[model samples]
Target: MTKAYDLARDAYAAWGVDTEAALAALSAIAISVHCWQGDDVGGFERKSGTSGGGIQATGNHPGRARTPDELRADLDFAFSQIPGRHRLNLHAFYLDSADNPDRDQIEYRHFTPWVDWARDRGLGLDFNPTFFAHAKADDNLTLSHPDPGIRDFWIEHGRRSRDIAARIGAALDSPCVNNIWVPDGYKDTPVDRMAARQRLWASLDAMLAPAHDPAHLLDAVESKLFGIGVEACTVGSHEFYMGYAARRDIALCLDMGHFHPTESVADKLSAVALSISNLLLHVSRPMRWDSDHVVLLNDDLLAMAQELVFAGLLGRTRIGLDFFDATISRTAAWVTGVRNMQKALLRALLLPQAHLKTAEEQLDFTARLLWTEEVKDLPHGAVWAEFCARHEVPAGTALISSLNAYQQKVAARG
Candidate 1:
């Protein structure tokens, strides 16, 4: 160890925190890097569809992947730059096959390329059934449409997606978290909210009725507060999915950008952990609204890691990134976001959590406040530098220089 890291290590050790254990634990927490970031959520589907979902990636950055191969190459570079082994969160619309099947006709073979790729890299793969940016979803309503035919079509698509996810998980020997998030909502206030929710309830039942090995496939439902057009009401609100997940015994996804600015997802973790068996966190930065900005080492992100580490929820919570900023280098965005998340987790692990809790329990508010603030000024930077060094990844200006070089390499993309 360097003199700096040795001193930092000794300092943390004095606080009754095991820096070595923290580093080891931080390495094990793999953040599922979203594949959509590489291509700004534009999947390689061969159909004319409007990108009219609540989600939209702003700016026309150079080198946005137009093909699955290109996206994979970008992902490969992003993963190489990020420390620790991580999983790729794949969307169904990113299918790679000559069949060019519609959503309803999608099968397992369509994702064979991705599975093979992940297998080769010793990385686990997560799945998402894309329920937006299509002709059927043009109205911002899907799976809960009034027309039975449209609902049936979406239901079949979800069923096939689960099957594909199951096969992928089985192949990789990892449970694939197939998270479902739909844009079924109303721009203006609707009179009959009950009807739409009823339809959605039935569609979800039919879609998830097919039995799959729980060891291979895990189902999760994601909820949103509001989308661009769906400002009045989102069909799958937080309360709706929280109750559903609790009743159905499935995982609930909590996106950092999907809630109001005042809300603290960090506080909800302990409460939600009481109701649900598992959780999937979509870590992102929300700029005033759900703008989906690239994540940074901000207060909210730090609090999230603190909750996970303090509450001992990291084992049951699957951490995934969900942001798409096309204004910057996509690969740089990925590397930055993932590394920030790792950094936050590392900081949490290095905290004297037990002592802080004891202080709180003993009603020693002064000690609690003092200890928390003191950690902020500690030589955590030295420990983090040691971490990046051990992982053979660059930091500070070196990282920026490497990302700039990569941007130049991919700048020729039309």
Candidate 2:
């Protein structure tokens, strides 16, 4: 350990916080890193089309992975820079196979390469069904489409996705979280929102009817407020999925970018934890809307980590990142986002919660406030540096040269 870390540890110990315990806790929490950012949400499926269903990667940034191998290479480098053993969050369309197959026809064998790769690296995998970027979803509808045929196609895709997730989890000895998020809504005001929701309800029920071992697969549903085309109405609104997940006793995914700009996802954690057995967080930085910007070490992110630690919700919560920024180096984006998340979590773990909670319980609001603000200026950076050093990962400016070199290497993909 460095002298700085020792000093920082002693300082934290003065606050009745065990820095060693906090570091151990931080190491145990794995952040599920999304793979879409490596290639701007472009999957490797043959005959893939543009992402039209409110999903768009807005940049001509070079080095975008064109194949599954290239994407995995990028992911491999990205994971090296991160400090912990994390999981990979994958979309269904990111399949790897020699033969072409539609979404509904996909099988586990198609994704065996990914499973094998993850297994070799001792990593877990989570999954999502691609509900957009196809002829079926061209109208910004899928599960809730008015046409029965389209609905059936997406329902089958959902079923296939769950099976794939189960197989992946079983292979890796981890429970894969299968999350479903559809871009089903209306650009203009719809005549009947109820009809669309009814169809969605039926479609989801049919898709999730088959049961899988909870040890292998955990199902989650994500909600969105609005999207590029779906401005007026989003069929699967927060309220809709909140109730659905509660009734079905499944996980509810809360994306930071999916809610209104002013809303606090941190506050919703404790409230939603009461209704659902599991909570999946899609951690993203939303500017004014669902911009999906790279996460930073900002107040919003810190508040979320604080809530997860203080509320004692970490055990039941699955932390997953959801951001796609094609504007910068893709691997660098992953490293920065994932590292920032870890930093936030470490800071939360280092908090003197016992003192704060005791003060709160005793109605000493002044002491609570003082301590809350006081902990903000603690030596979190020193401890975080030690963590990166222990993991043999570069910290701060050292990563810039590595990212620059990788960018230069991949720039030849033209």
Candidate 3:
């Protein structure tokens, strides 16, 4: 394997690509893996009936983590199989509460265990305000709800979430990316769209008014094109959030699965980077709609990585995974999605960017096309294998056996 990597390294070197530098850079990147994937987005909050959040995890896959300990154990197993250190993304509803508390009343004490867990493992943490699947959101309106009392409830929840995120970051000494994504929209065209948006704008302003140290917390707002119930009009559309983020100078989250099926979220990276100082990408796969399937090393994923690399915006971007698949082993899903994302980044780093850029600058379009096609056939797999080996992780299909053994001995245990 070392010989193969040596040869591959020489080949990349000929293209003016430093394989060692690429590996070092890739190692420094930490993708935020969402915790919802392990438990099908089910939180410990006491909510009767099914989730009303316009989102649903469509499988009864056994072995879903029922407690905070189980979830942490599963996350530990998943992280072991994937190379590189990564952060964990959590929702406010996932609080370790014995007496299910209301969203607005949640305090940081409920999440101290998570902080301790992450601190002990040397992992960073990110957070989200759970604006869905709760009683306040039962009417499909949260921050935009006409009733001031109801709107205030959600606003307070958002505020508490940000404070908690700051605490997590302060405890770990790493800035936590606290993202806000509300499931407020209409199933059909509304008579007062403008009024609803106005209310939402005001609500956000109030929620984000309290200043937290930027060193400990970074704020972001996520938008979606549509969802299961909010088909006709989503209050937080892409245009809305983009404008708000630019005007407010906050990070904008570009969720891969939250856009139109025909639109490439990768293409929007550079465009959004122009206005927003920091960007957060919620990497996911969209099947027809916002299905939130496990990510694959497909063209879209590759394009996103290449765009980030080419634009030299990787350091400024927060890359995170946002998929949940319950049909397969949850731990396996986490490992597969995170590894595929790492693979995409590695492939992007292996590209002969200097040559390609020179060809384009010289107006040698043919040469640019030729080099692009040629690099695709290069021995990237060998380099990736070497990366995994260096990181002391299983390369290629070898991870499957480890995942299976873990499922039987740990995840599947009642």
Candidate 4:
């Protein structure tokens, strides 16, 4: 019998990822940039110094602060890097430096250059906004209170964002500063959370009701753990006014990395599929402690995510890499993660629709349920060994060489 991996290899190899077509698929591309190269290596398409709430490539890794010119050069580099025919879009997330010349300057001078750079790359500016108000050089800041300083900081921050929007709209261009994440939702008490929620969506309300074009929408990202409100933040969105947001056609950003043990992947994707106006795709892996490892796909999580995509639950979704590369330099991390993700995606496209259907259909509730509950705790080698033993995949030294050769062939393209 032909195995799934063989099918995946064949399907992906022949898969028509026409460059021009792929470029057209991007609503935005959340890019990962490094400080060390500055404007070298042709820069990046979405040349931001950061990507996620904590994925500050420059700070997390060792990179320098780029001057605007260098940043522009980086943009040019990225623009030229993608084949003009390929469909690569941009979503720029500028790491709003607290040390910059006030909120106004950061928005106008610091961030705008990159926004313009995005245009040069045939991209758009759909930022995730800044992550909370407070400044912390500590990983220990997770789930901490919204520092008073941070809250006030964000207020002024939002104002500056509004200024930039006016500038972009005045130019008749689309300017979106997406506010989809709240890193400060961890609290212990059965707390009154309305005020906090209001602060989160105030700008979104402005966009939906009395603001500019009703087409201008904010994407809300829902999570399952490890931030304000321990269990306070559920897997799916539980905002203060979801109905109002929905009425406005406010969309949701579904991060595959955020689903927990209890949430049914099928159920969640179906729900997200309905809200297309404001969709953001965040992909990552869940580790032993529920920590976001930002690892490769095939993590079982993406298997579930793929099931949704295959079912047409995520039609025309804009995907973003809200990932982290903690072990290596941020630049290298981008190359590794993005390359691996493409491989996983190709595998997804190659998955046997019939097999998946049969598995789901044939599954006894008790047996199929094991997939949702059982997360491997041992080293990956052992886990893979066990899985290979059960699934009957090609194993041993030759298998490693085969996979490596596959990766090398894919990587050597550029």
Q: Pick the lDDT winner.
A: 2
Which lDDT tens digits does candidate 2 get at residues 1-414? 999999999999999999889888988999999999999888888867655799988787889998999999999999999988999999998999997999999999999999999999999999999999898999999999989999999999999999999999999999999999999999999999999999999999999999999999999999999999999999999999999999999999999999999999999999999889999999999999878999999999999999999999999999999999988888889999999999999999999998999999999999999999998888999999999898899988898888888899998886
**Candidate 1 positional error at 56, Å:** 0.8
Query: Cα RMSD (Å) between model 1 and the true structure?
Result: 0.8
Candidate 4: where is the Cα deviation over 4 Å? Answer: 1-101, 104-109, 131-156, 159-177, 194-210, 214-224, 228-244, 259-267, 275-277, 352-414
Give the per-residue lDDT digits (tens) of candidate 1, residues 1-414: 799999999999999999999999988888899999998888989976785588889888899898999999999999888888999999999999988788999999999999999999999999999899899998898998998889998999999999999999999999999999999999999999999888888899899999999899999999899988999989999998998899889999999999999999999999999989999999999989777999999999999999999999999999999999999999999999999999999999999999999999999999999999998888998888999889888888999999999999997898
Relative to the true structure, candidate 3 reaches a TM of 0.98
Q: What TM-score does prediction 2 earn?
A: 0.99
Q: State the local distance difference test value for candidate 2.
A: 0.93
Which regions of candidate 2 are displaced past 4 Å?
Answer: none
Q: Which stretches of candidate 3 lie over 4 Å from their true place?
A: 47-50, 410-414
| lDDT tens per residue, model 4, 1-414 | 235433433333343322222223221233322222332222222323222332332223333214445344433432332212112222223432334343323454445555555556555455443433334313212222246454444445544555554454344264353544545443354365555455445534543333444233234444445543344442223433345346656556555555564554435555655544555555555554244444475656456445544665445444545554434333334333443444344334433444445557886556445533432211223322333344343346745454445334333221
The pairs that clash in candidate 1 are none
lDDT-wise, the better of 1 and 3 is 1
Clashing pairs in 2: none
Comparison by TM-score, 1 against 4, better one: 1
List model 3 lDDT by residue over 266-318, tens digit each.
99999989989999999999999888999999999999999999999998999
Cα-based lDDT for every prediction = 0.93, 0.93, 0.91, 0.41
